[model samples]
Target: MSVINYGQLLQLAWPEIILTVAALIALAADLLFFRQSALRTRFLVAASIASIGCIAAIFKLLPGSSEGMLLGGVFLSNPATHLVQIALLVIAILTLFLSVDSTFTDHVGEFVLLILLATTGMMFLVASQDLLVIFISLELLSLSVYILAGFDKRSSRSAEAALKYFLFGGMSAAFMLFGFSLLYGFSNSTNLVQIASAIHAVPLNPLVILAIVTTVIGFGFKIAAAPFHFWAPDVYQGAPTPSAAFIASGSKVASFFIFFQVLVIGFAGAEGSATLHHFQSGWVPVIVTVAVASMLLGNLVAITQTSLRRLLAYSAVAHAGYMLLAYVAHSEQSLAALLYYVATYALATLGIFGILTVTEKQLGNDKISDLAGLSRRAPFLSACLFIFVLSLAGIPPLSGFFAKFLLFTAVLAVSPGSKLLIGLIIFAIGMSAVSLYYYLRVLKSAFVADPPADATPIQSPMLLQLVVGLLAAGVVALGCAPDLILNQILKVIHASGL
Candidate 1:
């Protein structure tokens, strides 16, 4: 192992330091200008803008750089780190836009600060090569989210959701830590690189199996993967809409990065050196089982939901399942496609939820039945909703379709003979069909039903209207020209060597 170095640590932590400083400066401004809500709101918006600007700065700063492990191997600066940070930045920008007219009014400054902190933790998690770093970053992200979930302390439901989520999240975190302990015992190393080398240098033991199995369960809960996804629906339904959007997009992306990094990078053969490389077939069943059940449970349960928020919660779970199939393919095409899918999904989901938050404030309920005949009442909002739902359904000529199509084609190229692969593909096709029923159901209600005699016209903000416009255009643009994104994703895949 290389001796400890201070310079590399600074380089690795610069981005995170920038974000931390911004949050402190913004919070100080909030405290200094104590009595004026208008001034506070304006400054809060400015702080969010500055935070996003710093994210852009980091993007420009880190793309081609390589600073090895930092914080004694806790944080890192590498090409893959840059990719995950970019995704987090996108989600942060979306959250800022959504917060403008939402219920984050009373504590906007604090909320914005916490959002930046949550993102900072996520960045650390993606680059962490040590168990200590992973555990710290995980708790950092989770604590911020728990408070965000219960931000509306006045509401019992929100408080209840936060408590329940915290309990489950904390328990899973403990499990992960315990597994890491077992791994450390087996390998005599806490660093991922060292642990991997040790794994092959010695024999696999009971502690090794326990470490891998238990850690998967821990991360599965974090990503809301099947069997570990029980907390999602309730927490999502209870959190403030913008908070829900943040968790749905940011947490999922960040956690998935760490997940893939663990399986693909840590488990991969060493740099330019040959060993018994993985066959990958062993991972297929675990992923396939999660994918099938997530699709069946998330989609089927969503069909019975009257609450739009609850429906979206399940829909996100189903999407996770779909994305997992691409991972199972274990090819460059699939990896590239997964990144594109994540980017497009983040933008589309944030835009859709932005509108939902706006309309909920104007109409006060997120019930699908309450939204009956919304087309006549608010044509533009209804149209935007239709586009998003269509995209979610993987309808042709939308980004979602390309995302699913590329995944299927990639899987076919790699494992054409396996019955498991065949079954998964068929299940994907069937689930797509099953998904259409629920997706189009919302559209049919919007366009075909009659507006209530006493229904009121929804007044949405211009900013939200613009977000929807961009998302709708993006869905069509990405779908028609996936090659535009394919190149960027290809860079990411090659760099990660996944």
Candidate 2:
């Protein structure tokens, strides 16, 4: 066995280390201020410290040249991983921003600390190249999120969300662990690179197929894909809005990153090998079926939703389908598209949730109808909401449109002559069109519908407004000039030699 190199490992893992230290510091600060009368000030201090830590972590992550495998090849530092770490950190910072004056502000230090821990987990998760590392990192992320989901002790809905999430998440973890065990049984290894090499030498077996399907299903739950997405709407509706945003945006980015890594690396076989062909044949069909179901079901179900949070939850399911298109294609370009799409999706979704949080605070509910006459009362907020909603619907001149366009284009590029892929593209287009109706429904409530007699202007904190405005601008910028980010993603992919 190769000896571990401590110095190199530290360099590769600096971001995670910084984040962990930051979380501990935040926790200590929380304890220190537990009895303080200046509750809001304590929360602000914790948030500020966490934000500084996140910024520091980003800097640490940015210095690398996307080279090196650390800790005996269990962790990798590449351009793709760096980019994902940056996105996760940004999402954490945004979550911190939303936490101020929100539901969990009373427990702000714990909130910031949990976000930091989750961010740390995701950083490790995206960089992980071994099953053991993957499982541990995933748990770190999930456990933090579970607590954050139920942080509001006074709300039974929050408790229910946590319980359901925990139960479902536990089952998924079991399935994934069993599947990983199967993989180890076949390959005698947990390291993905070694597994790929080993699988190339082993005969394809029934257990291999089972492992692939089960593992995908496990990840399917993580990404909120259809048939495994039952836990999302309730959790999003019940959890504090910032927690929901973290789960939806930050968690998703990390999940997809790891999923892509596992698929592209672990089961990949030598060219022309039976194992490669068998793996693809076994997994692609399953992915395509899930994608089709997710798109159709998510879009169709979202139309009937009255609560804005639930609507976004279902919409997230559909977006997962769109991202799954990248897996089906399984090429470097497709992976780039996936990364680009999720980044844009996270921006819009987080912006929407931030606005929703403010609205919920002022109106005491997140019903779509509550946004009526928002244009008259808070034009800036309403307009920002309109932009985010339109982006989500894949409307022209918005980031979501370009995201879908790139995804579909990558799909077509991989198999231009395949009639089945063409049909899938068409179906995806139809679903996008269907999604517009619901998105527009919300926009109509915000912009066109008359306010009730008691309607009053929303008084969002300036920080919230700044956060949403920046996200809105990011959505528009990514829409209009996607290459600004896409170019960087392609560079990362190229550097990784994918």
TM-score for candidate 1, residues paired by index: 0.91
Tell how far residue 267 is off in model 2, in angstroms: 1.5
**Candidate 1: regions farther than 4 A off:** 39-56, 62-67, 71-73, 200-206, 268-284
- Model 1: weakest 10-residue lDDT segment is 267-276
For model 1, residues 1-498, the per-residue Cα lDDT tens digits are 566576777766777777777777666666566436674365446456546656654765466655565644577666667877877876786676667776544666687788888988888888787888888998999999998888876777788878888999988988888888876876677777676666543234546556666777788888787778888888888888878888888988888767766655444332111112433322344566677888888888888888878887888878888888776776787777777777777767776787778667777777777777889888898887887888888987888888888878877777677666677888878888988887887787788888789887878778768767877888789989988877877886676555
- The 0-to-1 C-alpha lDDT of every candidate, in the order given, reads 0.75, 0.86
lDDT string, candidate 2, 121-175, tens digits: 8888998889999999999999999998898888899999999999999999999
Prediction-by-prediction clash tally: 0, 0
